[model samples]
Each structure stands twice: as C-alpha cells, then as structure tokens.
Target: MDRRQLEYFLAIVQTGGFTSAGRRLRVAQPSLSQAIRALERDLGTPLFDRLGRGVGLTAAGEALVRPAKQVLRDFATARASVESVLGLTGGRLDIVALTTLAVDPLAALIGRFRAAHERVDVRVTDPELDNAVTGMVLEGDCELGLAESPGGVEGLDHLRLRDQEFFAVLPPGSAIDPAHPIEVAELAGWALVSTPEGTAMRTLVDRELGRCGAAPRVAVETTHRAAIVPLVLAGAGATVLPPRLAEDAAGRGAVVVPTTPRLVHGAVMMWRSGQLSPAARAFVELARLDETALPPAGTAGPTRSP
Candidate 1:
C-alpha cells in the first residue's frame, strides 16, 4: 500500500529472504519483517510462503513483482525529475543487444557514444542472442534495444538500423582461401564452432550444409561471439559470424571466407511506446551510421550523433 511496504517486499524477493533483504537494504531485520507483515495485511493476501530454505513467492507475490519494480522505478524517476528541475543528471541506459550486434558495430557504437556523452551511463542486458532485445522490450527495462529482426514483439516502436552478412572465419593456415570463399561442401571437413541447434545461425548453417549433402563436424557449441572468434584465431577450427565479427576475428590472424548464399543480418532499434530521451535519440543516430561513421549510410537515415 505504501512505498516503504512495497520496498520491503521487493527487498525480500531480490535478496531471497527476510534476513538477507534486511542486510541488503541496510534496515533492521525486525523492521523489515514488520513492514512486510503490514503490506500483507493491507493487501489481504500473503505475498510469500516459506519454503525449506528461505522463502518462495506465492502466486500473488509473483504477480505483484513487476508492478512493484515499476513503482520503485517511477518513484526514483520522480525524485530525479525534481532534482533535474535545477540541474541535469545522466542515469543508466538499460540496453540489450543481439549476439551479432554485440561485436564491432555495437561495441564501436557504444565506445563512440560514451566518448561523446561522458555524463551518460549505460548498462547491457544480453541473454541468449535470439531474444535478448525482445525481452528488454517486453520487460520495459531497456530504453533502446539493438536486435536482429525479432518477429513477434508487439506494442513497441521499431526501426531497421542496418544490415550485416555472415562470413566464414577460417583458422590460421586454413586451406580455405579468403579470395575464393568457402563452398557448402567445403564446410564438412572442418570443425565448426556453432550456435545451438535450431538457432537462426545453426538452422541456416545446417540447412545450407545439408543442401550440399554435408554437415559440419562441430568442435564446440557456445553462445558467445567472443569465444567463436578466438577458437578460429587459435587454429582450432572455423566458425560463421557477421561481417563485423569476422573482421575483428580476422584481425587477430584468422582468415575470412565469403560463404555460399550470403547470410544476412539486420539491426533493429526498438523502444517501448513513449517519447524519446535526448540520449536515446543520440544512440539512434549512431546506430544508423554505416559500419564506418560516414558517407551515404549517415546521409541516408536518422540524424547526426549528438
């Protein structure tokens, strides 16, 4: 009912128990307990039920969790708004990016943006590559999300920023030639560092290789772009990734091979339904820039970086 009571309940959920929550919030244990009890009394339902170890959320608790977080965020925003009436402050940018985007373009974009806007703070929320940005949209946490074309998110504003294509990254001394590119059949003999089966990348790679009546011999299965690049550079195997990722990996001495049926990647910038922040606008500008921050890509869509 009250902010204090809501805060108490949230503390309990986040820290996983009355005692731990009290410790985290720097509140006396007894006061934390009383506040939660008061909140339950106001709502006329138990928020949490005791399990063997700490505690677990009841259905009611689960339902209230997100709203509680939103309320807390709102309160913090309100306080910050009052302060900003006199002076401005830059808080964190809750962001999520797709796997392919996380490499050079995204990293370069972040570096450029942060360098310009030293007052702004940014936070990332990359989970599994596929749903990372969409999840941020659904949760209403991210201010802006950079993603591949996520098929099913609704009630959000989306803009296509740029496109990328996948390339074969070959190990040092690899027989695969950078100039010739690799054929669908050529992939079968090499160890592939692959995304999990059924992912967009995996499906594309598998389907392409299969069409040639071949399947890559997978050396390792991992979800991180950083991992794949290194394995290729180390001469362990080859992997497929977007152009930007390929370029970075190849800089460390791996060879990049163009593949049959060029793989395409898209970058989408999505925001929850609302007005834009000055910072968000600046980021949108940067995201639209060509892999290089110049020429036709900049002249075409979006505006200059702020």
Candidate 2:
C-alpha cells in the first residue's frame, strides 16, 4: 500500500517472522505487525500464513514480492538521479558476480571504483548458480552482473572483460609435473574433486574433458568454491579450476599443472538492455579503464598476481 508497509512486508518475508523482522529493522514487533496487516488489508488478502515456527508467504504475498522490490529499486534510482544532478551525492551500485570472480576482477574493480566515487555505495551479490547472476540483472534486482560466457541471454548488454586460463589441481604427491602443462589425456580415469554440475567452471571442464576423449569420474561434488582446495590438498583427487583458485591453492604445496590446450574461460560484464543509473554507468566506465590497463589474459590479473 505504501513504501513503509512494503518495506515491512519484505523485511518480514526475509527475516521469516514479525519478531525477527522487527529486530532487524529496529522497529517494535507490534508496529511491524501493524504495518504488514495494514498492507494486507489494502490489498484485500492475507499476505502471510501464521505457522508454529515461522510465517510463510501466502500466494498473494508471493505475487507482490517482485513488484514490491521493483518499487523500492525505482525509489532508490529516483533519489540517486536527483542527488547526481547535484554532483554524486548519494547513489548505489548493485552487482552480482560468480563466487570465484569475487577474488579477481571484481575485487580490483570495486576497490578502484570506490576510490573515485566514495559517496556512491557498491554492493556485490554472489549467487550459487552461474545463471542466477544474469537473472538478477534481467529481473531488475541488480544494476550489473558478471557472468562467464553468457550464451545468448535475450535481453542483456555485455562486454568481454577477459579470458581466464584454467589449471589442473593435482592431489598431494601427484606424479604430474607442476612446471609443465598436463596433457588432456592425463586427466582420463582420475578421480576428480569437482564443483556441482551446472556451475560454469564444472561445465567448462566437462566439455573440455569430453573434447579430450575422457569423462570425469567425480569422487566428490561440492557447492562451496573453497572446498575444492581442501579436497585436493587432502589427496581426495585432482580437479580443474580457474588459475587464481588453482594457483592460490598451490601455495599450500598442492601441485597445479597447466593444461596442454590451455583451458580458458571467458568472462563478461552484463547488464540489462536499457539505460543505466549514473552510478552503474560510472562503474562500467571504470571497468573499461581497468580492462584497458590490464595485461593480456594469462599474463596478469588475479590468477597471475602474487
């Protein structure tokens, strides 16, 4: 019904109960309940169903979630627009990136962007699935998203930032030479520690392995990005990952062998196909500058950084 009511509803949904939402929003429980009840009345429906442990959204509440979020986004955009006219007073940039990339290009870019526009806020969202990054952008949940080889998403404008090389993460006491590139066939029949299926890196590795005439015998599949390091280190099995992650783990005495054909993954910065907020545009420009200044892929960047 109103911005405050919508805010309250969203908070309750996120925190899972009126009391929790009140604690998060620093509002009294009774006041938060009253606001949501008023919103439900205005819409002529029950937004939440009371349950013993926690409240769950009713069908009507589920329907209102997207539009309510959009309303809040628009309000933030409107405020930022007026403030920008008065010279970058208050603005925010919301970005979504893959968990692996949170270490590289995204970190450097964020650091540099913040230095220039200290007043503008920047938030990064890392979703579990690779597709969710672009989905967030397309759904108007975020202003920018970093996706790897986003294949033909209908309504996105993207720029290729870099192509990153992949490395073979050898288990402890691996016989493979760490100083040289490991040939494709070397991966055959090895029990591999891997990320879950459908992740960008996992998909790429699977395709490349197939091309090299082998299939991975997955020993363990995990969703956490950092879990691979410990798996390989503990001698679970060999794995393939972006160079940054592989090299970082190598410092722990894990052998990281390069692939013969140079397994490389492409990264793109994508956004919705429309005009962007001033803060978003500024972030893009900063990325462009950083990309130009960066050394050719595999030569420098997070993977190569000491």
Stretches of candidate 2 off by over 4 Å are 89-91, 149-152, 300-306
Strongest candidate by TM-score: 2
Q: For each candidate in the order shown, give its overall lDDT on alpha carbons.
A: 0.71, 0.81
For candidate 2, list the clashing residue pairs, or say none: none
Cα error of candidate 1 at position 114, Å = 2.2
- Which lDDT tens digits does candidate 1 get at residues 1-306? 988888889889878898999888999999988888888898999999988669999999999987786676566556655655554357556678766666646787789888877777888776575665676565656667777665446767776765666777777777654666467678888888888874556766787788889877888887765677777777777777776666666677777777665655556778866655556656777776643444422122211011
Task: Show pairs that collide, candidate 1.
Answer: none
Query: Where is the poorest 10-residue window by lDDT in model 2?
Result: 297-306
RMSD of each: 5.5, 2.9
TM-scores of all models? 0.81, 0.87
| Candidate 1 residue-wise lDDT at 14 | 79
